[model samples]
Target: MKDHHPHKSLDDVHESVPIHGGKSKFKRVISFFGPAYLISVGYMDPGNWATDLAGGSQFGYALLWVLLMSNVMALLLQSLCTRLGIVRGKDLAQCNREIYPKRMNFVLYVLAELAIAACDLAEVLGMAIGLNLLFGIDILWGVLISFADTFLLLYLQRLGMRKLELFIVGLISLIGMCFLAEMFFAQPELEEVVTGFVPSLPNSAALYIAIGIIGATVMPHNLYLHSALVQTRKIDRDEHGIRKALKYNFFDSAIALNIAFFVNAAILILAASVFHKNGMHNVAELQDAYHLLGTTLGTEWAPKLFAIALILAGQSSTITGTLAGQIVMEGYLQLRISPLLRRMLTRLLAIVPAVIVIIVFGDEKVGQMLIFSQVLLSMQLAFAVIPLIHFVSDKEKMGAFVIGAKIKFFSWLIAVVIAFLNFQLVYEEVTDWLSEIDNVGLQACIVAGALGLFVLLIMTIVYPWILKRKPSRSDIHISFDDLEFKQASSFRTILLALDFSKSDEKVISQVLQYNPAISRLILIHIVESASVKYTGGQSDDYETRKDLARVEQYAKFLKEKGYDVLFELGYNNRIKAIRTMCGKYSADLLIVGSHGHNGLKDIVFGETVNKLRHAVKIPVLIAQ
Candidate 1:
């Protein structure tokens, strides 16, 4: 038999820290709320406040029905987002890129970027408006001040997510207090407030505002944000904990939006009671109605309270919006754009237009832009929503956690209606623009623009459906058993391959627990795959010899620990050489680490461990 001392230095191979037994049930359950609560605040932005105020004021309590309905819908979708992260161990954007084709993935990326940009614009405007209301400063200067918020966000990241969570919770509480205070002071008649809660439509304009409330509250970017954030927690596979987490998510969402609902209702109630009855109708700007609070309520408390809440709402939502943009860009593009760069990109997009409008037309024009931006965001929601619903429902991707029948039906119904509503809104806006242009050439240009947008919209809706076709079995022919490995028995020799990646330590640690049963341990390093370009004329054989020396050093360390060991080096055709080593040594098992690449690379390359297992007879183990 070959001398076992050949593998003596194997001890130097990367080893993982042992996992202590699973976490307690209580700890796992409580950990779930951390992410859900942080991500939900994206819905409670100043833009949302404006919409709710607009909804309640113009139509009174009739639009409250939309808030109730949209929250229920958001709860269902957000729950799906959490489930996808927990079960797959990946965020929604990463999953979509893995399952979809390159061209389609590009389209999804552009649409998401546009939506986030639109949202960031809203935050910038809201912040500027809040500053204007609070300090009597120029809105342009307020927009410039908003740039410092990006650094503040980066600073918050250093304190860790927990600190950020507590901050948002406190801010949200302040918003609740401000609104509650305003509601008490305004003291609208109980009978009129009760009438507002009943479901009814005021007019076409009110209906559009109601749709905006739904769109702003249950945003598409937030679905991506929540899914990615949930992955930060280390949760066990305990089914009960997952269920508890889901329940907490629903409760967190309900409470956050309930605060939102009352604030929205209060805005409208204050507006309707103060402005509508006095014949000071059509309060386009928030400041327009601010003076009435002091005059009608016989106190200055209401205006100051409203301005403070608006500032809190703007700042709080901006933090989340910035974080969501980071998660989306990183997850989908796989590019690590620095936080400063991302912040600048979003801020510039928002501030330039905001500054131009304020400088050209003044602060009064900001509200109209706010309305346009919210509607633009509403139109973009389907882009994120459709991909999420489609990918989560696929069994091959999501496995046992695939969306249930009832959830699927309802999600698709909402997706269809949202797409239609966005389409109609886009159409009306374009035609209305064309109607304003009297010149024939400008009208012709508008017609072509509308046609192009319609085509783009149709393509976005149908693209996922087209990609859902199942691949033929022959296209991805490997069987599950081909990748499966059995635990080692005493008589066998095991070969372990190490790549020094993050996953490498995990595999090494798992293998060390085996009983000293294996007659031999081979620690092999193949230098053929290493890049030669940076090695400065070093021959392939030279590099292989050097790696072999390292392998021998590793084997020596293992031998001192009383385990039989050997080392080998190979320079060419890695898969072929690994197979040859297994056959020559009659190795009983092979272990490798994988990055868990899915889809095309998985199909074409057949995974290194899977390829070796098929080429030879030994069992193969893959550590992710």
Candidate 2:
């Protein structure tokens, strides 16, 4: 239950992905590839299919412009997320936790969770629908099957992050290929498809679907997910490395999201070419699209491929959504849970609503359900987006990495456009609901809820500018004359842990020179080999034997120098063993040699110096 890296985002995978130095430019670019692909799936999830299908079938290629605009917004926002993670080393949620009060963060966390749940709802419905269309499974059974699929996440995550990334990338590729083949069969006119980018809403209904498309494309959860995901790569914490990471990650996001854009556009275009062209404009349901594709294209494989792609999209997206859920929960509340438990909790939240809808309204309502879920996602988008813009734009925290005015202007513009669209959607939806309802009590409750959300939204937008954020230490400058300094004290007893490396001699020499009046020198080494790890000092492993011998020689050399020396070989658990030795010897100071390992090497060899310093009360000096 110990918080080893309390400030870490996605602690299990933070800097887990190795980035090799001195590699080819292509190789370097490749290392930063996976995080963005994970993000791209969220953009092309089942929610996207519903919105895109609805837009295309109802209005032909008119809303293709929406998709294009949304992609541009997504690319820019995700790039900002990459910058925030690389420059600040915190996810959006963690940044919010630091900047906002507990109550405010709780509200934001709730909103974020709602967005994740809405996204998961689309995944559940899409998976169930895919199962029903492909196999003869009932919707209820398919829902159950989808819930059971949460276990698959456990297996996938057990395989490590890189493998999980590969799996997601494979699923994304399958989805893209399926849509590509669908395009070839539908064969829409190039002239009309290009014109879809010209931006025109055919009717007010088109506005609703357009907003849904925007919500589906520029996801709220993805903003949180991308920032945390970028931290997976073990890039050096230096300006050059950060610049390279920023550049490579921008390329990564561009390529991955453009691929996502293609998949989404392909869906809309296919719906336009196959459904609208054939005068079946009411093809809103994914089920309808599936059946219509086979008949309209005169090939059974078309619909089969459609179902397969839907299943892949749902499956892949749910996996990443669960991951985002983990990031959000840990970052906001500092609450850590097992991956399986987190997946189950999120899946269950999605399932309860899905089950109720499936039972109460039946399968026919699911397509509407998917679109509604996406609209909800759009409503929640501003909460995540606005805070992200605020965090990355702050000069005090971001140092030299603060976003420039041009980027800031566009980022705010995106936020405002999204907020305005969401506000409009809310107004229209509320007005329609109030008109239809006869009960004043129900209307009052609805109005109150809307007012509350509006206030929260305004607060989200205004709070960052109004509230004074605590500045980082780097931003605080003081004159030397204004500070008080404590007098230096010499140590009587020092405990030094040795690894028998070449630096040990240098470390010992420095320790001797540090305090000539020191009364005792306790030289210790922990036998960290597998045999001694669990067996403590009982195992007679070759590595342990050599380590003990080396400690004795050092102790003998120190004793020859007319210094009282005590040497002991600890078993395992370097920090614990060193702490125990420090207490036993009553050491006033501890000296340890630094291997200068960082990033992946720290993960491999263990961050002994850093961990040991915190584990013991005595001062720890790293002999470089």
**How accurate locally, in lDDT, is each candidate?**
0.69, 0.86
TM-score of each: 0.69, 0.75
Where is model 1 poorest over a 10-residue stretch in terms of lDDT?
Answer: 1-10
Clashes of 2: 0
User: For model 1, what is the error of residue 486's alpha carbon versus the real structure, in angstroms, after optimal superposition?
Assistant: 30
Model 1: per-residue lDDT, tens digit, 1-624? 011111111011101111123477554344445555565566777677776666655766567677777767777788788777655655667666655666666766776777777777777877777788778877889888988887887787777766777788888789889878887887778887777667788678977776677777777788887776665554444665445555655665566556666666667677777666666556646676666677877888788888888788778878877777776666666666677888888778888888888899987788878877776777667777777887678786566568899999999998887777666666676677778888999888878855765676666556667756533221112556568788945646888776545776776675677666555778876665455434532345566666767777768866876678877775455677788788778888787787567679888755666566578776788777
Question: Candidate 2 overall Cα lDDT vs. reference?
Answer: 0.86
Listed per candidate, the RMSD to the true structure in angstroms reads: 13.2, 9.9
Candidate 1, RMSD to the unseen true structure: 13.2
